[model samples]
Structures are given as C-alpha cells and as structure tokens.
Target: MYGIVQGVGFRPFVYNAAKKYGITGWVNNSGGAVTIDLTGDICNVKKFVIQVVKNPPFPAVVNKVRCVSLQYLHYDDFNIKRSSKESDTVKFIPPDMGTCENCLKDIMDKRGKRYRYAFANCTKCGPRYSVIKELPYDRRRTTMNSFEMCSSCKDEYTTPRDRRFHAETNCCQKCGPSLVIINNKGEIQKCEDVIDETIELIKNGKIVAVKGIGGFHLVCSGRNKVVIGELKNRKKRPSKPLAVMMKDINTVREFCEVNEKEEEILKSSKRPIVILRKKENIDLPENIAQGQKKLGIMLPYTPIHYLLLEQLDVLIMTSGNISGCPIEYKNSSALKNLKNVADYFLMHDREIYVPIDDSVVKVFNGEECIIRRGRGYAPSAEHMEVQDNIVALGAQEKSSISISKNSYVYTSQYLGNLQDFNCYRNYQYVIKHLTGILDVNPKIWVYDMHPLYVSSAYKKEGIKIRVQHHHAHMVSCMAEHNISEKVIGVIYDGTGFGLDGNIWGGEFFIGTRADFNRVGHFEYVDIQGGDAAIREPWRCAVSYLYFCGYDGKFIKNIDKNILDAAIQALNSSLNCYKSSSLGRFFDCIAVLIGLKNFITYDAEAAIALENIIDENVKETYKYKIRNENNVFLIEIKDILQGVLNDINCKLNEGTISAKFHNTISKLTCDLVLKLSKIYSISKVVLSGGVFENEHLLKAVYYELKNNGLEVFFNSKTPINDGGISFGQIAVAEAVTKKQSRE
Candidate 1:
C-alpha cells in the first residue's frame, strides 16, 4: 500500500482488520509504503483486503494497493512488525494534519493522562511532515525520538486495541515535550501555570511568540487596535493584512460570513486559513485586514492553539519573522530575532525538523483555491502519467520546489520569496531535504526563463529545461484539469518575462501543455523607473495618461518634479520597459479613482479595487482589440479615458471600482471568445495571480460558462507563482515525451 500510508496508523489498521477477518498476518512500513503479509481462507483474506483498501483510517489516503499471492505460511495471530528501509522508490509524504477530536478530548479530559498537555497527539493527527526527518516514519526517525515515552505510553503503544497503538508522536506530560515561558529579556518566567500566565499576558495586550506544530507565531489579541498597531510598527509591516485565529466556527461566523464549503474547510484535518468576506460593522480591529473587505481566518489546528484560545475569542497569529524573512521555527532564532516584536515567548522543546507555514485558501465558484500552499496542504504528492526523475525550481516569488519519482510528483510547502537571503537559504534547504527524504536523483532540472530569478540561478548538474513564466501558469491549470487538447488560456499576473524580452503579464495563449502560442496581450505601456512603478502606482498612472494623450496633472499627493522627470523618462524611453501587466493597469486605475497612490504589499492596489466594488453596478467600459502584425493587442486607452471621465463626474469610488472590474471581465470574455472561435477550442483555462480576485474570477467564470464553454482553473495547486514549479514539471514531462517520440 502506497500514498500517505506511512505514519498514519496504516499498520495498526491492517493488523486490526486482519484479526477481524480471522486472518493471520503481519504488517510493517517499508520504503514509504505499507507491506502486509497474510495467510488465511481465501474468502476471509479477500474480505480483509477489501476492508483495508476501501475503508481505511480517517486520514490514510490509499492511492495504490498492490496485492500478490505467495505460498502461505501459517501464523499464530496478526502482528505489527518493525519498519524496513530497503528501497528507494518513495511514493508520498503525508502533510502535517490538524489536531483530531480524539486528541482534543484527551487534552481536555481532567482524568486523562494527557490532560492539558500542549503536545497531545495520536495516530489520527499531529505533526507529520514538519517533525519527520526521514522515510519509514517511525518514532526513532522523527524529532520525537529525542523524548522517551513513559511506561503508560509504552503500554498503549504495545496494545493493539488502543487508538494510540504505534503512534509515532504519542506521549504523556511525564515524558513528552514541555513548554516554557520566557520574558523578552531571555529570562525564564516562573509561574504556577504557564498556560494561565500566557493567557494573562495576552489579555494584557502583550504580544507572545508561541511555538506551534510547524513554526513560531507572533500572537496577540485581534480585538486590540493599539497592540495591533504596535505589532505592525515593530514588525515594519504597515498595511499588509494579518491572519486571525478564531476560537471556533461560531466565533468565525460572528466576524465573517461563511458558506458550507468554507466551514468544512475550516474544520478539516488540513486546517488552512480561509479568506472570508467580513461581516458588515463587525467589531474586529481594522488593522487586522487594513481596508480590505475580506479577513483571513483559521481555526485552532494544534493543542497549543486551543489552549491559548481558551480565554480569548480571537488572536492575531501571524508568522514570527522579521520583514522579508522566512518563518522562524528554531527556538534560538525566534528568541533572538523576535525579542523586540514579542513581549514573551511561549515555547516548547519539541524540535521541528522542517519549517512549514500555514496554508492560505479561499473559496471561489464553490471550489477551494489555494493562495499559499503549506502546512496542512503540502509536501503534497500528485499522481501523474510520467516516469522520470525530474526537479523543478519555481519562480522567485512564492518559491516552491517539486521532485518526481516513478509516476508521482511531490511538491514542497510554500517557501517564501527568494529575494531575501534567509528565505533563499530556506528554499535551498527544502530542496535538499525533500530530495533526500524522497530518495530522488534528478535527471532533469526545470526553471523559469527569467535570467535573474534566484531559482533560475541555482546551479545543478542535470539536463536543464527553461519554461516561460505565463506558459507555466497556463499549463499548471491544464495539468490540474488533465487536459491535453488545445485550449485558450487567459493568463494574467503582475509580471513575467515575455518571448520578446519585455515584461508580460496580461496574456492570451492557445495551446496544450507541450507548446503554446502567445496570440494576444494588453497594449504595452512604458513602466517608468521599472520596479519603482510597481511600488508607486502614481508612476503607472502617469505613464498610462501620457500614452493615452491625457494629462495626469490632476493626480494629487505626488511631487510635480518627480512626475515631470517620470514623463521625461517615458518620452526618452530611459529606465523604462514596455509592460502589458494587467496588475499595473489595476494600479493605474486605483490611482485615477483615488484609491491609493502607492502600495505597501504585492497586489495591494488590485486587492483594494476588488474590495470596494459595488456589486449592484453592472456597467462596463469600452475596450478595443487591435491586430498588429498578426498579434492582437488589447487597447486600454478607451478604458482609461472612461475611468478619468468617471472621476471627473464625481462618481462613487465603489461604482467606479465595480465598473472597472466589470470592464476587465467583459474584455476578458470578449477576447477569450474571439480566440476560442479562431482556434475552434471550447476549453478555456484561467491561471494567474490576477485571477485571485474573487470578484473578477466569478464574473469571468460565470460569463464563459454561460456562453457554453468549458472553463478550467487551478484547484489542487495555487494559481500564483507558487504553482509555477508544478507547471514546469508538467511542461518538462510533456516536452521530454514529445522529444523522445520525434
């Protein structure tokens, strides 16, 4: 049995099933798979096999089960044997799972051995990928090997009837990892009850750095604006939204509107943070989400979190790291780096072998869309139809790595942008760690085409394949949908290197996974000061106005000299590159309609535009698709002029935002329809960061579906740069197959 069969009570389940079916058998974990040997009546053995495969444990994902017949040797009874490490073909690694109800009950039971234990866990839940150091996941191979189990725990492990039987992370307070409270000065705080002390500190508006299953989190009261503001100031994160951990589903419902799907995701074993629309006039601190209409909320996924939230309704549980750094998981590093940001440290001695961040998700069109894949959702393995040892290093931002073994592709959790030295180092570490654990020796290395991408600069000895960024995005969706036929892909994002050596984001491609033709894109506008235009929306606004023959003198809160210099640079084509980024277009509109003149985070302007849309408005602006040299260019001058006219007319910001969003949706439908008709393809794939906007995605999805076209989107993987590595893997496999055939 393969596919998440390790460390998930699969052996124990098999033993129990064998006994129930009156079969004598032994089950053990070996080479990342479960091996079962049984001897009994043929009918009984068949029933046991069916039960094991069809009705596995709660969290065991049985992807493949191979059965073979051999000369049977009678055994006294069913037995759980020790694991073996004799093979290199590893199939899957289960992701870190949230705490199960049974474990929670044990922690809450006053008479239980693990009462109030912060590290309460069993076979059903608790750390897997984060604490794992190698395959054949046994206690000795994980970080828990450092802590010895007491006699009571050993008894439970030896007993087959106990749920904790053979649980790798099972232990009581007497032998398990213990928590310690330390002040910011690195002095130990002596308290009768550490949980009570931590709760008091949080209630007093003090930030606490709490160690969790994967990493440390900077936690505080979500209702306190003063503390939230202080946290933002200390962390140097002004406008970026912070995620809040609510007490339970009821608490989440009080602050945000939750549909059935969102609630199910929140309560799932993979408890990811779900982005939900905020309830009107809620009492949550505005600093939690800045001015955005949606709030990122998650339920407690760990025993420590549940204990921490016992006296609080909601807590701001943001990543514990300095600006531009990966999440801090080490005890010494968290204390040293976050001393100024946190008032106290609620830490534990449990060593986390691999650092993983909480996954972020949102529901779109009644399906889950992963924004950042991590903790509960990764080290994810997907079954593909290819056999090759390949490695794909994703794009610089939202960096992730994928390795292929046999016919399975295993993707690492989300590693942050590679621009920061710490994040880049972590990225390298994850690649080494994942490849080492999976025992994969790569024959092909795939990377983005952008020359300056940190991932592209990674040196390795293998056959290299360079993939275009937007093409990777489009193919990622294609790979998820398992579509090989020709389709029209509307890939839009902030930035990507184009075939002509220019910045491309708004793109229209028609092709399959192996190859694609860039048939259309938004008209190019000079991006004055290059990256500066990305940081300051006013520059893009000025450039758009200049290109559209409109004066930007009315734009306020910007230096006139800087504006004149930018316009001069645009005219001289100095320090300016032509870009067709729809993200930049949103930024330009945001400035024109008085939303923001500058941004503090990636896609801030676009997010704000989406947040303020008036859903009642149904009007759209006019756009033209002009053919130049057999390539279609989406002209935005008319759209810009309409936005400017709306501003002159003093239209409400919400109405203008809605109209602008509607215009983009209309133009997208029009373009996709035109391309689909030309190519005679009904399958349309949408993949990019720009589609992360729920409003725009809903508009385009319903429009295309209503028009009788098959629309596909990335569901299993993120649609952002995080999914690029998977796409690279898919494209590499396709290219390899095509080349071999030729």
Candidate 2:
C-alpha cells in the first residue's frame, strides 16, 4: 500500500527485517511505505511483513501499515532506496518521548562513542515535538538540522543493524548543540566550557539558571541553605516549596520513600516531579518546602539533567522563569527575562519549539498523583465515548484544555490561570498547537458557567455550553472514576458563579457522572463583587462572626490597631461581600480563633490551619444541622459562636482545625444519611478542591463509610480547581448527548 511515510528510515528497518528472515525484495520509502518488489517464499515474506509491521523503527508510530498484492522482483537481495516526497495528506506526528535505557547506558558508558555527552540521544530518547519546526520528523525538520552528523556517526546511522542508525536526535559534542555560561552581570563566565563551569558554580553555592526541554529552570545547590535562600530572594517565590531533583530512583529513596506505584510514575516517560514525603532525618533546606510537611521532589528525566546532577550530586532546580509566569525556553529570553532572577545563565543552542513545564504530582493509596499534568502525562488522550469533537477551555485559573474527538479527550499541558498577558498568550499558543496535534475541528465549545472567563471567550466561535461550577467540580471526580452510573456528589470549593447570580461553593447533588441536578447548596449570601472578600479575609471573618451574634468582639480583644482595621474593614461596604463559602468559612474560623485576619495568598489561612491540625486528633464537639425544604444545612453559625467565646483562651489550633474538618465531615455524613433515607439512596461521591486536605479527606471518607454510604474522590487528579475543567467537559458532554436524544 502506497502512503505518505517515505524518508523516515522505513526502508532501512524493512531491510533489516529482511535479513532477520530469509526473504528477497527491494524495499524503498517511495510513497510512505516499505514498497517491496520481492520474489520470495510466501512464509518468509509473511515473516518479513510481520516483523516490518511490528518493529519498523524506533521513531515510527505506524498508524496504517498494510501489505499489497503480489509484486515480483528478479533480485537476489533486499535493498534500501532513496526517499520521494509524494505521500498522502494525513501525517502522524509523534510527540516527544524520553530517553531509552540503551541510550542512557551509552551516554554514561565509558566505552561508548557518545560518552558523557549531555546531548547524547536517539530517536527513542531526547526532544521530539519541542525541537520540531515542521512535519515528517527529520533532522532537517528539527532543531538537530543545525548539527550535521559526523562521518563516524553517519556510518552508525546508515547501518541497518545499529540501533542509532537513522535515530533523529543522534548527536555528539563535536557536531551538536553547544553550551555557554553567563554570570548575573550578563557577561559570559565561560563561553566555550559551560557544563563543567556550571557544575562548579552550583557546587560553589551559586544559583544558575539553565535552559531545559520545555523551559528554563533556576538551578542551585540544594544542599546549600544560603544559596537556596538567595535563589528564593531573587526569584521572589516565598512560602511555596521549591522542587528538588535527585539522581535516580535510588537517590529518591535516600531522600524520600517511593512505593511501587510512586516508582512507576517516577520512571514513566513523563517524568514529573512527584511530591514524595521526606524520609525521616533527611536534612534539606527549610525554604525548600517552607512550612509544609512533604518536600516536592523529582528524579532526572533527561540526559542533560542526569549529567549535570551526576556531576553536582544534588542541586535545587526550580522552574527557570519568574513566579506564576510561563517557563522560559529560549536562552536569549531566559537571559533577558531571568536577568533579575538568576545569578547565572546556562545557555544552550538547541531550539525549543514547544514549551513543556515539568509535571508535578503526589502519591497516595498506591496510585499515581497528578498534581499538574504536563510533559509525560500530557497529550495522553483520555478515551471516552463522546459523539463529536468539542473544545472545552477550562477556567482562567489553573488552565487546561479538554479536546474531545469521538470519545478521545486530549488535554493540553497545564496553562496557569490567565491573570497576565504571558499566561493568556501561552494559553493561545498551547491551544493552537493542541488543536493541530489532535486534528480536531470542534463544532461545540464548552466553558465554565462564568460568562467572563477567558476560556469562555476562546470558544465563542462554537455552540457554547455553560457548565455550573460545583456541578463541574463533581463531574471531575465522576470523570476520574469513569463512573457511568448515577451517585450523590458532595461538592464543595472556594467559589463558583451560582445559577442564581450568587457565589456558590458548598453543594450537594444527586446525579450520574454525566449530569447533576443541584439538590442542596450552601445558603446564598450576597457576594457583593465576587472577589472583594477573597483578598480581605477579615471581611469574611467579620461577616461570619457578626451573623453568629458577635459585635466583632474577637477583633477588640486583639491589638487596637487590628481592631481599628477590622472596624474600618467592616464599615467599608465596598470591601465586604457576604458568602456561605466553605473556604472563606475556614478563613473565618482562622480569624475567629485569632489566628489570622489576613493572608498573602489564596488558601493561605486554610493551608496553615491544616498544617496545625494533628491528623490523629479528633473534634471533641459535634456539629448541629438544620433541614430546610428537604435539604440538610449545617448550622456553621453555631460553631462560629462557640469559637467566639473562646477567642482569648489558649485554644488548641489542632482541635479547632479538627473541629472544622470534622464538622464538614459530620455535616456531609448527616446530609447523606438523611437524604438517602428520604430518597432511599445509599451512595455518595465526595468531590471538590477542598478535599486536597488529607486530614479532611480521610475524615470525610471514614465518616461517610461508617454511616453506610459509598464515597469516591479524586484519587488521581486533584480534588482542587485544577480538576474543574474535566468535570465541566463531562457535564457539557452529557448536556450535548441529552439534547441530541431529545
């Protein structure tokens, strides 16, 4: 069968297969196939065909390979022929794959020709999509075009028996990408010798920004607290943990424990930074994780990283970009943009055409933790039974695009919340590339119910479907579980634009994974401008305390300056927004206990509270609930009042946090029990971003099961807003399918 597959070394692989089996043919890449003119025995030809089809080459995806009718060659041998450009319209482009074990050994092996070469890679390893500027995945079509193979390397490439033969990324120090180093002053420290100098600088406690596969990473000596601190100061990334990269699985175990599942994810082609818990007594910089208990650690995924870290032993390789900005890919861009952040710039010549940020994850319950899906995890098409192609632009925050083409869902790499032009621009770039890769012509567009979301605008060209925020939250868990049956969805999050023009967070639903009907939600309060209370937690604190009959005494009991600020904050109607938000309620609880009236980041107060609580501890008091209109409502006002009286007491923060966590758990269980008895249903699915708190997750899980109810959560993707888009798409698909049926 003639097709578009020539010039990709398909012929050489066929020739090699012919040698493996006793066959005679003249194979060539004429029209994208092993065009064979053979006069061979049927059985040998059959074996040749099978081998050719099964193992064409390292770089081949082989979308369609079919044998043709009888064509006889009066030749005694199988030979390779030059390629022609006449192929079909459809071209199967392969995404980037990681280094193969053979290539890794060859790089590290002393006897190998490509010894200790940072750029040593082949078709099975190294950059693919990121380095490719055009299709047909050749040296000319890639960043490697600048680096012509030498005579020795060329022989290996042309040898049919050699694995490196025709490998696209084959390179060595003499003819491949070069490295250079510059100090903070923009002066080249070592123009000709970078790898060794960069390693020495890192070992000397200097932070160097190095260009990587998808972007730049600010590298520093992880073992040096002072250097890490300096890197943190320059990066301006406070509190958030800096990711630490180790050598290998063994090194990872030396720093942290890795279970079978954790090891599996670590070794996967998409080598994401898996946030593993620190093994006891493993000393690391305090700033690495800040106040958190677990350290975000990742193993080396690339040969360059392997070589660099192998020399330095341990280095703190944080993302090579400004905080909240896209990762830097180009050396010039990193040099220019990272001038203010990095102490040194480690430059490289290979071009980065596609930006892929490091994937981040955690492991629990013996399964993979997908905190941020990118690199190896991305473009991993989630096969669902969808009817048509649709584009679902996730929310502006923690952005991801879900593309559905006849049941396969392909989500783009993690695009951060569209707060800046950089984020928005990257969002556009990722979307364009993603649409190109999937070859999807979407007719229907999906978005979060919020009309003003950037993602909503992206899909303006299609039949737009607005998905409810909490409903989508539930649907995410449903999607993760691949649940086709109906179940109760216990959904709670920070905030979502409610159907009634109010802000919603805490919600409960009874529906299938596809569709959910809002059964009960937290009591609607006037969220004045939606964002007013989020920035100022004191407003939420004051509102909750005031509703519970406190004349803001908790503030007065504190410093006069604090009390005055609280008074002014309460008086300013412009700053106040009434809400029954569970997250804000947690913030209010933190405030009521005189813990914090202000926060520097989103979920700061809540996260701090979780940090304080002992998972082994339990809430001494139980929560009370009120049933309204066949829905159970937990009277949080009572909890607010009780903590108000104990404002000045030496209150146990753990107890308060536990009480808060347990109150929600008890309330949820009570709701499920009462609702199920009323409706004769016995299953509940717990979802939402709030469940990321391990303490609360376990509490809710056990309490619900103790009450004879089935519970499900995001064991894979986060239970946070990061998972919102998946849920939105599921809901949109259901709506679309139901509409079609109607």
Candidate 3:
C-alpha cells in the first residue's frame, strides 16, 4: 500500500482483517509503505490479502499491492509491530479531508461524548498534511501531540473494534483544541458558548474570521448583499468572484443548476469549491459573482462550519487575506491582518503547519478541471514511471513546485503568484518542506525558459534544464494521461518565452517528451507597452487593427490620448515586443466586441467573452494559413476583418464571440487533420489556459474525435501555469535519462 496508509488506521484495519481471516501476520509502517507478513492456509491468506486491498480505510488511497512468498516463521497471532524510523518516509501526505459521515453523526448525537465537539474527527477523516510535522505519521510527530487524549478517548483508541482505534489525531471535547471568540481589538470575549456567540454575530450580518483546517476565512451571511459588499470593500477585492458555503447540496441546487456530477462532487470527501452555472431568474445577488454567470459554491466541510451553518441559510466564505498576501494561518497573524476586515474572530488553539487555500474546480465537457489545487488535494503523489530524482520549478503565474522520487510526483499546494513577497516566501518554504519530508535530493532541476520568472531565479546544484512554456503545457497534459509516445499537442494560453525570442501562445507541436517541433503557430503581433498591454486590452486592440490594415480612427471606443499613444508606439515599435499569444487576440476581440477595455484581474476579458458564447451560432469566420519554408503561420487577418464587418453591421457581442471561438476551433481541427495526414499520427492532446474555455474545448474535441483521432486532455493537473511543474518534471526526467545514457 502506497498512499494515505500512515495517519489513517491502516494497521488496525490489517490487524482486524487478519483476526477475521484466522491468519498469523505482522504489520508495520516502513518509511511511507506498509509492510505485512502473513502465514496461514493459502485460501484464507488469499482472502485476507484481497480484502486488505479492496477495503482500505476510507481515507487511505492504496495505489498498488504486491504479495511475495516468505519462509513461514510460525507466529501464534497477528500483531502490529513498531514502525521502522531508519528508512526514508515513503508514505504520501493525504490532504485534509472533510468531516466524514460517521463523525457528523457523532457530533449530532445528543447523548454522545463528542456531541457539539468542533474538532471531531476519526481515523477516516480530518487534518493530515496541514498538521503533520514529519512522518512515519506517528501521533508524536503531529500537531496533536501536545494534547494528551482523555481516558475515555484513550479507551476507544486502544480497542481494536472501535472506529477510533489508533486514530492519530483522536481527541474529545475534554482533550482537543477549543474555540475562542475575540473582538476587533484582539481581546478574548467572555462568551458562555462560543458557537452560539459566533452564530449570533453572523446572524447580525457581521464579518468573522473563522479558523479552519488550512487557514482563516473571512465569513459573512451569504444572503445579505450589504454585508457581502462590505466584505468586498474591506478586503480591497473589487471584482473577483467570492465563494459561498451553502448548508448542503439541496441549498446549492436551489441557487444553481446541478448536474449529477456536480452534486456528487459537492458531497465528496474532498469538499472543494465547485463552480456551477446559476439558474435563470434565480434572483441571487449579482454582486456575489459580478461579471460571470457561474457561482463558486461549497458545502460546510468542518464540524465548526456545520455547527454555524446549520443555524443560517448560507455564508460567504472567502480566504482571509489582503489583496496580494497569502491566506493567514496563525491566530496572531489572522488577528493582526484581518483587524480591519473582520468585526470578530472565531479562533482555535490548534496550529496549522502549512497554510492552504480552498481548492477550486469547474466541470467542462463532463470532466473536472482543477482551477486551483490546494487543501483537500495537495501533498499527494501521482504515480509515474521515470528514472532519477527531479525538481521542477513551475511558471511564475499561479506558481507551484513538484518533486519526483521513486516513480512518484509529489506536487505542492497552491503557492500564489511568485511576484508577491509573501507568496514567494511560501513557495520557498514548500520546496524545502517537500524535499525534507520526502528525503529527496533531486539530481536534475527544471525551470521555464522565461529568464525573468522568479522560479527561473532559483539556484540549486543540479543539471539545470530550461523548458519552453507551451511545450511544458502540452507535456503536463501528456503526463496526466501517462502517455509515453508522441502526439499532436495543440497548446494555447497566455504568453510564454518562445524559442525564437518572441512570446508564443497559440502553437501546435508534434513530438514526445524528449523533443518537439513547432509545426504551426498564430502569426505574430506587437504587444505595445509589453506586459502593460495585458491589463489594458485596448493596446492589443490597436495592434490588431493596425496589422489588419485598418485606420486608427476606426477604433473610436478608446480614449483619444491613449489611442494616439498606442498607435505611435506601434508604429515606432517603442517599448513593444512581438507576441503570437492567442490570449492577446482574445483581448483584442473582446474590446472590438464592446467588452471592457480595461480589466481588474487576469483573464477577465477572455472570461467575459466566454460567458456570452452563443451556442446557437455554428458559423465560423475565415482564416488563412501560410506555409512558408515548412513553418506554418496561421494568419487571423481575414477573421478579424470579418469580425470588423460584423461590428459594422451591428452584430451582437454573443454572435461575434461565438463566431470567433468557432473560427479558432475549426482552424485548430483543420490543422490537426492536415498534420495527422502528413505525420501519420492519430493522437491529439489539448492543453494550456485557453483550453479552460469549455466552449472551445467541446467544439475542438467533437471535431477531432469525429475525424477519428484519439483526443487527450488534462485531468490530474490544471491546464494553466499551475500544471507547468508536472510537465517540467516529466520532460526533465526524460531528458536527464537520455543524457545519462549518452
């Protein structure tokens, strides 16, 4: 057994299983693996092994199980042996899980000892990665070590038949951490019942910073628009959507459309925030999710959350952080940082070892794409077959890190953008923590080709290799699917450092993990003001218009001074760089179709455009591809001209958006088919942040699959820069092995 077998009561489970099967055996934790020895009748032994493999503890994720014959040294009975501390820790750190159903029942039972216990947890669920300091995952090595179990809890832990037997973090109200309510000045309040007081504050429409498994969350009543607006104003968050913690799946269905898959995910053990489309005329406050039609919602995951939410309809649960800082984890830090934002604080004495944000997900084409991987989904290794130790420093935006050891890739939690000081510090801390915990010394260090990336600045002693951004995107998809052979990779996203010293985004590559050739790409356009152009779409709009041979005066929506400056900069190529970014093109179209010329957040323009896609319009605009010297250049002048003509004819933004999306999808499909014929390949992988757009993904997926091509997409990791570390690991490991052979 490889995954989540340590902190969870796997040994006790094995002991019980052995007793039931009448087999003599010994079980113990070795490094991170579970080692078992059994001696008995062949049939019963086989039954025991099958049962162990099939019915592991609810929190245990058994990746593989192997049996080997050993000379029987007769033992009278099976027993749990002491874990070996000399070996390197091989067990994966399971993410903090939501309170399990059994634990919930204990909390609800009035006569039970655990009734209303806010920190109620069993072996099957509760904090793991966030509480662990080191591993063989023993009780002494966790944050719960200081809290000695009460006599009653100890009795339950010692009994083999008890559900709490050998539960590492087991505790009752008498022994476990307690809740504390504090006022705005950080002074403890003398409340008889902390839960009731916290409920009263929230019911009165006051913001409270509630300590959770991972970190603190600023919470307010979800139904109160004024309170929600106040939260937004205090947090200095102008437009990004806020997530709501509903009472349950039933409450979610009332506010948003829930397919079976969405409902299942909402009720899952991970309890990640799921983005669902809002129902028509549902009358949800528009300020909750300002610009988008989708609502990010989650169910109460912890005992404290359930206790408070049971008294209210819903709560606005957002990470407790200022605009650019990481989520506050420490009680002192929460009080100091959230003093202005939160009116009161609901805190606990239990410490969080590592801060994590809530994971976010959205269903696209009936599959889940992880927008942000954290909390319930971090520190878990995905199995992969590779040689040597490797460290992959991911892209700058949506940054994360990964380490490869013994055929497993352990990706870190969501480390926010590398630009902010606190986020970068967190990134470094995660790197050190992962390396130390796994005892991995990477022989190869991988980074993006972009020289200015903060990740690229990391200095380490290894065979350093630089990978192109879009290529990493494609291989990230391939790694998730476990593809070892070559495929056609259609990579589209924001900007990346191109091999030719230009910014590349829209690209098609044909190759394996070791090497690839860029077979096709979008034609280059100038990004005036360089990085500044990303925040203001009008600069890209001007560049597109100029390249399409349109007069500057035609762009009347932009301010006169800004337009004049942009045109002059474009003509002179001043402080401008060439880019083949599909994202920039989308920005141009978004502005041309009358969306906001300026955006407060990244991908706002593209998201706005995607939100209004007219599914009824099936027509695609024209585009021309030029194959000069075998370097295919996809020119979008014809497409832009058609869009301009449509604008002149007074077309709705939805129709224009649909036509634009369809044009790209058709162009990509046409390119893939043409290349498939030329190269004799049938497998295609779609990746990059742009693929997060469901409309384009579905359109291209149908076209390619209908044309008899096997399509692959990202499932394990994100399609954005967050997945870049995984791709870097795959490519670097392969490249290192190839070089060693040479």
Write the residue-wise lDDT of candidate 3 on 1-742 in tens digits.
Answer: 6767887789899999999999897998777788898898989988998888988867676886766777769899898887775344355876788999999999999999989999999888889889988767777878999899999999998898998888889999999999999998979999789999999999898999999999999999888889999999998877778999999888898889999888888888889999999988775678888868799999999999999987997889999998778999999988888999999999999989889999988887788779899878897588888754788999998888889877889998888888888889989988988887787877889999999999878899978899989889999988999887989999999889999999999999998888799999999988788888998888888899888878666565677987888888888999898888899999999988888688877788999999998889999898998897887889979999999989999999899999999999999999999999999999999999988888888889999999999998886798888899999989987787688899
The numbered model that scores best in lDDT is 1
Q: How many steric overlaps are in each model, in order?
A: 0, 11, 2
What is the Cα-based TM-score of model 3?
0.97
- Candidates, ranked, TM-score: 1, 3, 2
Total backbone collisions, model 3: 2
Better of 2 and 3 by TM-score: 3
Tens-digit lDDT track of model 1 for 159-277: 99999899999988999999999998999999999999999999999999999988999999998999999999999889999999999999999989999999999999999999999
lDDT for position 376 in model 1 = 85
lDDT values, one for every candidate: 0.90, 0.70, 0.88
lDDT for position 384 in model 2: 66
Native-structure RMSD, model 3? 1.8
Q: Give Cα distance to truth, residue 574, candidate 1, Å.
A: 1.6
Number of the candidate with higher TM-score, 1 or 2 = 1
